[model samples]
Target: MLDTVCGGGGVREAWGWWGRTLGGPVTGPDGAAWLRVAHSPVEKAGGKLWTGPEDAERLVPEPVPRPRLRLVRQWTDGGDAYKAELYDRVAGGTLASGPVLTDAPSLPVAWWSGLRAALGLLSAVRTERTAVRQAYLDRAMPKYLGFLDGGGPVPTTAPAWSTAHGDLHRANLVGPELGILDWEGWGSAPAGYDAALLHVYSLAVPETARRVRAELAAVLDSDAGRFAELVVVTELLQSAERGDNLALVPALRRRAGEVWRAFDGR
Candidate 1:
């Protein structure tokens, strides 16, 4: 069992339970110590949570000199927020990537690697007993149909589907370790979902964004043009699912046209 070393005003009760479970020394981010027991991660249906199995399989943990740690507690009866052990605090950091993007020339390489990783996840899902492909198509097709009817360009036939990180972005990706967190929406999804998500988020940084798109296109080869359209459509669908925030809808629509035209060689 693990004890998260972080706590605040309302977290005391949760921490108490955590301490009781771990029955061992537990530290908080503030350096407060306690005792607790830990339990193995489990899956509960209809619960919008991503835990051990998904993370263990999808992510390749970067080697660290010391053990990577996290708070061993889940959202309990209290509220939605998690009470977790926090370790290896990096200082002097800001959440915003700023207007200027990092000179990550290897972003293409990372994109290629990520695509392969995404494909690997898809292969694993295919091996599972459940008909995962149909499940995704069921969800994906409706969105595509709606967008297409609304004059948005999108691929009707199935592209590729796989387990996706759903919200892959640079902020969620930590350096050196390449750790991805916030797995709330992790699940089986389309091949280009994560890559598209990352590309959208990286757009603020022109060079990084270009590198991501180019790399993805390069990897897909002749299919790159069609895949690029799929990427834009996926972003629009995801945005609509989150909330019908109309702010970026026009931009996405414009991009969809651009990608479709490019793919059709119009």
Candidate 2:
């Protein structure tokens, strides 16, 4: 399939890796491109996650430090559906080795400056598409926040709404170059949602987490940003219930309490 996508250019077999989705680097006549393919049940392949890259290409503006989508192909086999997306390859590696930051990364001053600018621009874009739905927030916040001490009853009302990358983790952040990847979930979310999500993912490394809060303070320190933190923490706690990021559960709970205290002070 990749050979067909690249018109016979070879995919780098030694560079391939997989997680929730599978992808690898490939060489085409024009240049090198990253080929990502996602598979889902046929009935489940019609929504946001399935069409995210194409939407990001059409909706997200340039100079945002993200790989541009070039081509997309979709096919169905029996009960399963597969979608392939080809994007311009980013040069530097991700900020962290994976979704969760396990160690502090030494990023340049320019990288932090670029990230702040990129997120500011992205948040200002007007879009009907939603990265974090109000309905999901309403449902998840009450249920997941209940898992934390004194987490229940934190209102889910967002002070403002803005475009977000949705999944702004270390793995999705390309560093030394400052490109954000995995646009599979970019759309309208609570203002400051991206910054809050990044801060949560960085919690495994205390210094990195502090850096995220400090670097993105314009958003992370706002009323909307504080609300966004609760939303992110709730989502992660829910994921933890499924045995994902279990290590971060304690930290997440502690943060929830701190945020709750801030709200109490208001």
Candidate 3:
């Protein structure tokens, strides 16, 4: 299907990183492009994940450093629905090899500055789409953060809200050039949500976590920022229950307590 769309473009490499998405680089007639294919049950194909990138392309501005989405094709086979998207190939590698950081990456100061600017610009864009729904927070926060000792009441309402790259993990962030990939969940979230998510993902490496805090302090230290940290911790704890990011569970719990103290104290 991709070959039919690419019109004889040679596939450079192909790999399935996420559960539902398969993507890699291809040398097309126009130039190098990334081809991503996602599959879903026919009944569930029209949901958010299926259409997020396309919506983001139409809604988000170009200066955000995300690759330009060029073409998309959708089709169904039996009970399965498939969609393919081709985007301009971005240069440089992800800040970390995967979603979680194990070591501190030596990023240029300019890269950090660029990230701050990109996130700020993104937050200013108006969008009706929501990344973190209040309903989910109302339901998930108490259920997950309930396990934390000394953790006070979980606040379902955010101090403020803004746009975010909902899943702002290391793997989605490319450095040396600063590109944010995986737009499957970009929309309105609690203010500082992106920075908080990045910090939590960097906890395994203390230096990296500290660097994230120091670099994104303006957002991470605010009332919304502290709340955002707990929000992220709640989500990670829930993910840990499903056996994902198991190693970070302890850190997430500890961080949840710390954030709650600051959140309640302030």
Better model by lDDT: candidate 1 vs candidate 3: 3
Worst 10 residues of 2 by lDDT: 11-20
lDDT of 3 at 196: 96
Model 3 lDDT, full chain set: 0.87
Residues 89-123, candidate 2: write the lDDT tens digits: 99998876667777888999999999899988899
lDDT of all predictions: 0.45, 0.83, 0.87
Backbone clash total for model 3 is 0
What TM-score would every model get versus the actual structure? 0.54, 0.91, 0.93
Q: After superposition, how far is residue 218 of candidate 2 from its true place, in Å?
A: 1.2
- RMSD (CA, Å), candidate 3 to true, equals 1.9
- Quote the positional error of residue 238 for candidate 3 in Å: 0.3
Positional deviation of residue 233's Cα in model 3 after best superposition, in angstroms: 0.4
Ranked candidates (lDDT, high to low) = 3, 2, 1
Decide which is better by TM-score, 1 or 2: 2
Judge candidate 3 at residue 263 and give its lDDT: 83
Give the runs in model 2 whose Cα sits over 4 Å from its true position. 1-20, 147-152
Q: lDDT per residue, candidate 3, 110-222, as tens digits?
A: 88999999999999989877899999999999899886565456778999999998999888988788999999878899999999999999999999899999999999989
Sort all candidates by TM-score, best to worst.
Answer: 3, 2, 1
Per-residue alpha-carbon lDDT of model 1 for 1-266, expressed as tens digits? 24133332333322222232223234455564432333323334223333432343335234211124444444543322333433334322223342123445343355356555543444344322221245554566456534443334445544655555555555445444334544445665545556666665554456766776676654333344355345545545575777643454555565555555565566
